[model samples]
Target: MSYELSHLRELEAESIHIFREVASEFERPALMFSGGKDSIVMLRLAEKAFYPCKIPFPVLHVDTGHNFPEVIEFRDRRLAEVGARLIVGSVQERIDSGQLKEEPGANPSRNQLQTPVLLESIEEYEFDALFGGARRDEEKARAKERVYSFRDDFGQWDPKNQRPELWSLYNGRIRKGEHIRVFPISNWTELDIWQYIEAEKVEIPQIYYSHQREVVERDGMLIATGPFNTLGENEKAFTETVRYRTIGCMTVTGAVESDADTIDKVIAEVAGTRITERGATRADDRVSEAAMEDRKKEGYF
Candidate 1:
């Protein structure tokens, strides 16, 4: 073809542009940091997008209390290294106070509960704009999201009546009690993220690579060892060479039987794989076809 920018570079440039736009448009905005690879890449992009000056926005994480220890460790250390403020919305706190009920089983996920916690956090902080690590290629509902997704005071996402996004222009216009959810990498794919990670030499959690751990086979995926994974009837745990494609609350997130222990290996494995990231690891989305969409409608970030 012609002499043009590579795919990864192009995606990076677009993401950077979006980051700056959010920074300019919103008075107070926060980047959602999960300490996962996607969020880590978002952090790296924020770093590259605004160098010489610290990221002008705070980063928030909604903790499901069923988090992987590796993710928590990486999250804390990275925030310290960047010298950025971290705000955490706790789901466990909601459960403790009888605001939400905990899922009981070998495969319990905090995906649904995170919605209320996120809404409460937003109301508490009065954040007008929230930057998420959502990608269009992940799920059907997410695919419907715009770069500047709007939400009401209830924090509900209505896909049908979305504001038009022309060219690279985003309209952050909103009324009082309503905020916007921005996704800089909405156009990115999972493979794109990994390629950028490889190209940028971004450091992510070690669990992304193949490591020895105790895992048991569940319905169709491997459920890993964690405090929230209460053993069920006939469930057996054994050590297997595995790594997580996605990390979320322990109860609902599943692991893949992978040997790709390195980032490069991971990239290769994902490239040939047919299943999408959420399809493999997320239990919440599988509850129904409109699972994510329904949650988003109810102010679930």
Candidate 2:
């Protein structure tokens, strides 16, 4: 009898293969768990990759100290369920130590500052490889990256100097001080992610579903009203039914107006939407045409 795998299964197989490869090839590796949809999917894939055995590597989170409280709560709960070790690199700690400075603005974001903290974590832990949930379709900069992206000794990325991944064979070679950022889900799209979550019954933060919350209209996006977000003079906070397309620092991540409360509804909504989540919701990406690219070059995950 002949059998075939569905598209979701194929994606899952590929991601699992990547996970196993990292486990076998790298001596010191960690999964970057941001508690976002993509990272949550990554965690699920990791679990399947090493079923009957707990995940071999620890999970790393670069805390910007500006993240949503709900996501943080979810991160801890999910980590406990999976029995994975958690390693956090705090941006706030770095700022307090005079190693990093907070950006000065009415709407200050710790997004850019996360790069240095991440690099410090890598150095402190001596991680030879780091697994990130970055997808190529998310942004143009990310699209240019290889599945096994290489980072220099200084933890910076040079897109033009990337190694070729000819065929399915990946080169995980790096110098002693160099490292790699492995993206297992580089080929998966936003719609594919929601579909996988729906099919697998993956548990994610409730903030992804539509709920009533106080939000302010800022620069053509709905910004949630919270301690990290300060409304402008003309901006007014009012209740709206909304959900997040992507999760990031609360100061920069925007919410979309939607009633997609369930997983099936989210998948349907994602299928019909033309705008990429980051393009529509992330204010930091709107700072410049090459905002993400610049950050990647400077070692931003």
Candidate 3:
């Protein structure tokens, strides 16, 4: 029987092609490793792009100082396993230097503060192109972004002025002090990610699976009650089986009540879900209708 590329295989091939293109075109390209499922998938694609040799570029993480403990641990472990260099830009240092101001609210999140730190890191490292694992299906703003998203000298993105990409041709053109954000899996959906994770047996952080955690309900979302979100007198904490559909800063990233502890179950869950990952899980996105778009215009990953 004649066989064609399965959906997973097609996605894999497209991602690998994008990785190779990024490697060849940009002089100083770096992979943005957030220790999330998407970034982990990007790392795997990079690994496959240049097998029998080390991934030629360093991985960068704009540490928000409010990450899940499990994700940070997994970041280090994955780096060691792949023997890839990791460069972390500290949000703590930015806050300490007064370059970045901490959010003063009951729900303080460093999610917005990450933009400047990421831009500074790019300038410091002189990285011309940055590989991000942002998929279009995650948000409407991301859906508007091109595969090779060009940024200005100040790291601002003009979504309306993006260069047209046709027939898999990527335009990596950018001026000095300007850069591009390259997304390999921009075409993949959330279910596709979970399916790939299961098929490849990828090791993700424990938080992605079902676990008991103390959470409080606020703003129509379940916020994990931790150091990031101090329990208020009005808000009572309760333990529940929950897992993160999309992971971000601990303060802003909400977990959905779920019992999908295994990858197989997660795939099943994702398949049946009608809401987008960020819509269900990210409190930051709920700030405004154009929150993500505004952040993207300001150089957010």
Model 1: lowest-lDDT 10 consecutive positions: 103-112
- Report, for every candidate in turn, its global Cα lDDT versus the true structure: 0.87, 0.93, 0.91
Worst ten in a row by lDDT for model 2: 161-170
- Candidates arranged by lDDT, highest first: 2, 3, 1
The CA lDDT at 78 in model 3 is 95
lDDT of 2 by residue, 1-301 (tens): 6699999999999999999998999999999999999999999999999998999999999999988999999999999999999999999998999989888979888888888889989999999999999999989999899999999999889988889888678899989988999999999999999999999999999999999989998888888899888778888999999999999988888899999999988988999998889889998898899999999998888
Task: Give stretches of model 3 more than 4 Å off.
Answer: 1-3
Q: What digit string (tens of lDDT, one per residue) describes model 1 on residues 266-291?
A: 99999999988888988777889988
Candidate 1 residue 262 C-alpha distance from true site, Å: 1.4
Assess the local accuracy of residue 162 in candidate 3 as a C-alpha lDDT between 0 and 100.
85
lDDT of 3 at 246: 86
> Could you say which candidate leads in lDDT?
2
Per-model C-alpha RMSD: 1.6, 1.0, 1.1
Estimate the TM-score of every prediction. Answer: 0.96, 0.98, 0.97
